[model samples]
Target: MPLRPVAALAAACTLALLGPSAAAAVALTPLPQSVRESEGSLALPGRFAIAWTGCREPMLERAAERFQRDLGRLTGVETFAAAGPRLEIACAAADPGALSLEAREAYRLQVTGEGVKLDADGPIGVLRGLATLRQLIETGPDGAAALPAVAIDDRPRFAWRGVTIDTARHFMSIETLRRQIDAMEQVKLNVLHLHLSDNEAFRVESRRYPRLHEVAGHGQFYTQAQIRDLIAYAADRGVRVVPEFDVPGHARAMTLAYPELASNPAGAPAAGAQVLNPASEAAYRFVTRLFDEMAGLFPDAYFHIGGDEVGDDAWAGDPQVEALMKTEGLTTKAQVEAHFHRRIHQALTRRGKIVVGWEEIIDTGTLPRDIVVQAWRTSNATARATALGHRTIVSAGYYLDLLNTAQFHYGFDPLDTSAAGMSPADADAARKLHPLVGRFVTDGVVVQPMAPLTPEQEALVLGGEAPIWAELVTDEMLDNRLWPRAAALAERFWSPREVRDTGDMYARLAVQQDRLRRLGLQDQAARARMASRLAPGASEPLLVLLDLVGPVRNMAHDKRVPAAIAGKKIVQNLTAMADAAPVDSLAARAFLARAERAASGEAAARAAVRADFEVWNANHRRVVAIAQDHPAVREALPISADIAEMAAVGLLALDALETGKPLAPETAARAKVVLDRADAFEAASARPIFSFFGKRPPADLIIMVTPGVRRLVEAAGG
Candidate 1:
């Protein structure tokens, strides 16, 4: 089946099919086959040429220059000229054509003047359209360039296309952040959600709270000037800068700034993680100052006061908090949490900006309607918030950092009526429904439902993003975790949904991934390499197999085989014993019994490993089959399965090594290793079954070792 657009695009497509103007609505489609031939190179008709007339911003100038240079390298276009060929490039402040499509946040590129005019809706859009145009001009023989004449009506479905960067986990250099922002513009994403503070550290410089950076940031905080510089840079790309100062929970950094603000009124423990004192006036004042600084620093008119995961137990036990809650008639801990959210929301709103927070803000119930709620929980919450008229953005089940399988991510829908019921479905069929959940919660509520959307969802979405959560993720892992996949998401966000062609994208991805590799990124390359190794007829002995196995367990969060696999070398070495010890004084029967015990133990271990494969593989099949029924699922499910299978196989290999048996002479001699030495190779290549034995199991698990093994075998092209 073909790929499906995200929630927004699906709606748009539905709407397009309704009336007289349906034919004119903008929709995504695959790039013309002729143009998509080259991965990074653009193939243009002989008659087309690109020219730039006016550019004032330094970034724009730099972007244009880079485009020109890349064009030369890829398609052999030494210079851009309006009169030279078929494609013409012109830079102007306004749309030069009488008839052109205008999008809200980006440049408006139009076909005009016997060629095409690059008139961006904004600088960001201009940059993106330029990239597209560049990709269209392909290299010909002897370093020559050409162009094509094609009309495209394009715009993003969302007003806030963004990528959330967790600067607090491990400081990402300003240069790195800026580069990412530049790329975001190229993909037409219009927002940057900077997670500047978290439980790990605080990364923004504040004069009022000098210690925030000095003590909490580990010397990795961004100076105020740096923040301003980033803001300005994003402004040029038509991207808004939204700063997050997570509160209540995830505020260990703040504890360093104001020890009295910790949940423990008695004060913070020596080595325990910090929690905030929601009842303290000082806590309120500190956060207010931070927001005040943020509002002044970021002019996006929307601020994120992270009202997420505030620990109720911490606040409940604090004497100071208890006293305050009693005075306020707050009987429950949830109420106390709500009070904190209300105070922070009020603080930000008073500063002339609306607030956005995780679904917990609503769970707390005191957040005002004007505050934008980001539903990072279940779709049920999304429906609840929207039904109540609050504007919400859904981010549940899409936490990229959680290391879930792609199928798990692909199964849910942002605009799904499953949570809201058949009323909306029937209404949609009747052409009378208008997604009243978000609009009905409150007259002023604006809900933005988001998660780390799949590439297919990106098409149906207003726009999608990749959120980098701090757990198990750091700046070092950023490029690896986000690349190629993130690039796929970016295209889905910018390109029209109808333009989707998976077979074409799969081919294109193969090339784009190489481009990323050449840019000094090997993580994405490793992922792709592992995927190929798992393909049928590919060599299983490739280095990628081992890596693939570990990642599979991480993706599924199933500890059975993976936990065992993690200790393969240890187990293998311990279990692999010499056949029978020649004990001169021992009784014959006793020696035989000892030998039998050893064999039984090894057999049990092998069974355990097999069990893990059974569980994971079965689930994999179910998920893949379910996904096949949904258009969006059908298109994006392969990545998840491929990754899981690789991880599983790798772990199984680790288990095999512990079997204590000699490998076949031919096998031992022929297999080339991906990692580890010859000894490690022998250990890893043993019987891929013993590493899974004897584990405490979860209750009522559906997908067992048998199914997991089968699914992996199938995926690995067994």
Candidate 2:
């Protein structure tokens, strides 16, 4: 409602271009004073009550049950008491009255004598109507429900809605995954692209290549039984699980299992902690064996083979790889990549698995016609892959892992049909390019980007997912990093783009977050706290949430502080309080105290504050130094200064709240001024820290400076 004029215009244009059938057709009306009690559900005078028909089909039934449950939970209405206007549900008869052709794709909700009858062509249409009904529900301060009357007929432009999860970086427990699958189904997402293997972790339990799990998994691989169970679980929820195994690159985990498959002359590590050895004969054999097992485990016909981020460095470094390149008469890494991938394609063919890799694989020009290229590098790559003869999945526009905003993801076109530079020109051109490209026969390219999908673009995208990369991820930090954010991703994958109106979705997500909490997801708790502030009645929750301060610590000034003292102040404060106590009340009390103190005007507060902070920092270092060696504290420290700074800020904010005043403005401003500089420092420092112990952090006496700053700020009452 507060949208800027240009933003509003842009949104309107986007909806109009997408077409009326694609957007939720609804009218917003003020709640009539006479019907204040009926603010949510069909209690309001202008509200629409919707009934369901033909929803008993197993899939529809399952979906309907979930939808009904979500509505009840979200609107906080108990249907059993029948206090609110009830929407009746029935399976349509052989000859139910029909709507006009224009309304065929969406539902027509009419108020009947007894209740509302929601007539739709099918279950999915009914589902859309349900979503519309959900949007209509509103609660007043006194718990009144209200809604506006409107006619909505909506359908998505794309049929296959999907999201991907990277199981390769850090293996997700089957339970955690099932919960994710359930979450997806609730949001109407139909597919799950499972990135099963990556450079850091090999998740498949390979019978033919036992060593893959034995060596690469570091005792964390999923058993074959688990994969089978997961497939069944996903199917039951109407979600297809498409497995991806990155190859010719991002293969360090595989090499760990079968060292022989790795390039005999090892090169520096690449993304995913993997560096594939292209010249190893053993690598080919090992890859084939792994694929054989993968094919058997994943029933879905399409398999992902990551071929992105295989830097040219590896190809140029190995002698045997060079020799092979010369023998094949290939001059570039692209050609060698093509040659190598073709071998994997042959292996996949034998196992009845269609290969899918990154855009780089297409850049090599050797993939088979059936292969799907997940283009992550650039839009040019999507068009190039399509032009070259490979089917493409547009991830370039969506890489949610890049910390990009959702609007950016929404604006991109998966198929470059509009661009003059790469659009298909004619029949002869099509024929020549069709043989090598996957898009020639079928509209093979589907855009499935990572998170941050606006409702409109999310609906427009074939689907979207949230990838969990391991650079800053660990077992302890996974849930905190992914949840709630992943829920937003699921919404994009499941809900139609037209249904997007972040305001409403954000509200619905709050209820979903509560549900996630009931389901025992700790990560969603952090997300709920962070996201709560974006909504009304959220200040209390946001204040209480114990934010992670490591990143804040890293963001502090260039002043090098020791790691031992990094989170010392926050940890000390937390230790002083009850463990796992609600951060909100604590934060509230502290903030009020600081406010009172600042208003009193204590100049002595300045010197006393600085000296107190210095002393606290020194004490924290001693405590943290001992704590770091305590084994427990030493194990969980983050590797990056950025994370450290973030952690420091979090701790300092908590302390500042406790003192009843804001952080010292001078220190805060100084930190802000140098934040960008800190980012660069972390980027340069991360490599050495990450590479120290085979991509793990190093143990040192001083600790990192990021965490130290966190200690200083927290001690300084901010």
Candidate 3:
């Protein structure tokens, strides 16, 4: 008989014998490519044990320790190392040490009646298998620790799945950074890109130039010792730490430390200084020395130069830059920028480093071909960079700071057709346009595009990153701002392209949120703490309000304060409704979507809608009571009242629909008026409040419940 026949017969026999056990298996996030369930389960003894062999690397030892700790926490049992029928972790080879194309980070995990067996080619793969095994642990009917019998073979689809944290905008503590790395490892995210310098601050200590951290860092920079420890910590968890020191532009902090290197030595601009003096040989020397020091600090091979947002006015008023431009026969500012990048690239290249920069650098075409271009702003930039023989990482759709829904990021893929909907002529024309020319032109300058990636260019795409720009994000809000959403993006990067089930992802994410919380990620707790601060004696009302609303999307909050006058006047506080909430209310959105479908006949969905309305209708009184005493809550009362009225109208419509009674015309009219009033309130509420000092918008409420309310009325009328 053929092997296929024998395999098929064995699979059928196994399934028939272990029907319930196979069916009761938990769904894994970043779903493994292949999984098989057999007849049986693994029960954890009073003392959980892990037996390891084959790899003597320090990272493997750390991984084993982590597994024991996490297993104990999750199962509430004492975990220890032992031999015999228990968890077995084996590596076929030594630790790869670094994450790269050749690193074997794939593993096979099998949990059976005998025990749990995890096998991998390297220690990194063993670490990944441990994450999956932890996720597989569940409580049995007898309330004992148990795991479903299953065999899973899994690997990431992309090699460079990463997250970029901007510590320069707002400093993050090393403890917080390490905690984030722990969560990233649990999600199998392998890279931590630290943006260490920006206009606001230089976030790393430099012994070579003390002032870079002493004066410019405002006492918030990380020491070299802390960074080395962090790198070691991340490595043990199989995460690569890539440090970014932005240059030329976003150089206010650097220039603050040494004014001689600035394009305009008059001091930083209101928009926080634009670029360094390309004409100054001293500036080049400073950058080179700084990068050399950074290279020593960050052992990772790739370094981000942050070559984005260079403005023409940056060098317009600089005499030295102008003189050099004239002497060098440089016709435009773009050429000057190109020269700046070329020199910086040469410096890094001499240090055996591969330079990485934003997509703006791609337009120069003068940098080394080995450079990695991060495409942000434009959709087609990824393809454009790849077509030019440069590797690309996409961040345009993965901008976590934009407050976009996780579904929005999930729908974006690196391999999407770059020119799918464009006309054939336009598509060809787009290809001919300068890669620097973005989709939208402002003041005759090409910015960034809004296009996608073509299939042919997909091979050059390494992966993508979710960047958390910290302009609006404080350290307290970091957890809520990143997690759960970042987890979805992680799946997009790790899982196969066909695993695009948003519903399933959400279901899995719910479990992930709890796991992350248990592992000490503080998103929920942080939000609750903020709510308690805002409400003092009573936080339930505030919590209830936050659960139904989220922050405004698309940088609307930032735009409210005009940039020209913003000038360090923009204050980030918990007073704004968005401050405590995330961009997307997944639970509310999913509930609304379900309610719309269930309005036709589903009893449970209808009840859910009714219960939501009742809660909101009662929440208004609670909000009003709390608002009188809390200024923060008072600022949101108008929006709260509108929500209450909207809910009241929805309850009336729901009643009419359930009773099969035609809604009174006046009642329907009142409902429409309430909806209109709510919309107007939201529009007016978004306007910035101009005061004696400056202009700033009060935190606007994200009206998540209104859409469901509208659906209820529409269903009643129909």
- True-vs-predicted CA distance for residue 639, candidate 2, Å: 20
Which candidate gets the maximum TM-score versus the true structure? 3
Tens digit per residue, CA lDDT, model 3, 479-574: 989988998888889887876766566656666667778888988888889888888988889888887777766455664344433454545554
By TM-score, how accurate is candidate 3?
0.87
Tell me the lDDT of model 1 at 16.
45
Number of the top lDDT candidate: 3
Cα lDDT computed for each candidate against the true fold: 0.50, 0.49, 0.75
Q: Count the backbone clashes (under 3 Å) in each candidate.
A: 102, 59, 6
lDDT of 2 by residue, 1-718 (tens): 1212322322443333223221222211101001111111345432234344554556556655565555555456554234445565553432221111122223455432345556666544565455445544555566555544433333444444566677776567787777767655444455678776767777877888787788778888788888889887776555678888887677777767666566644554332345566666777877787778778878877777777767656666678888998888989888878888888888888888778776667657655767876655445555555655665565554544433223334444454322212223332343453342223222222322323433443322332334545443334344544444455555444333344554333333444444555445665343344333332343232222222211211112111222222433221211110112221121222232232233343443333333433443344344344444344333223222333344345445545645767787875765553343444433432321111112112221112233334434545544
| Candidate achieving higher lDDT, 2 or 3 | 3
Error of 2 at 269 (Å): 14
User: Local error of candidate 1 at 265, Å?
Assistant: 5.4
Off by over 4 Å in 1: 1-63, 73-103, 106-115, 122-124, 140-143, 265-273, 404-413, 417-464, 491-505, 514-550, 553-718
Query: How much does each candidate deviate from the true structure in C-alpha RMSD?
Result: 16.9, 13.5, 6.2
Model 2 residue 297 CA deviation (Å) reads 2.1
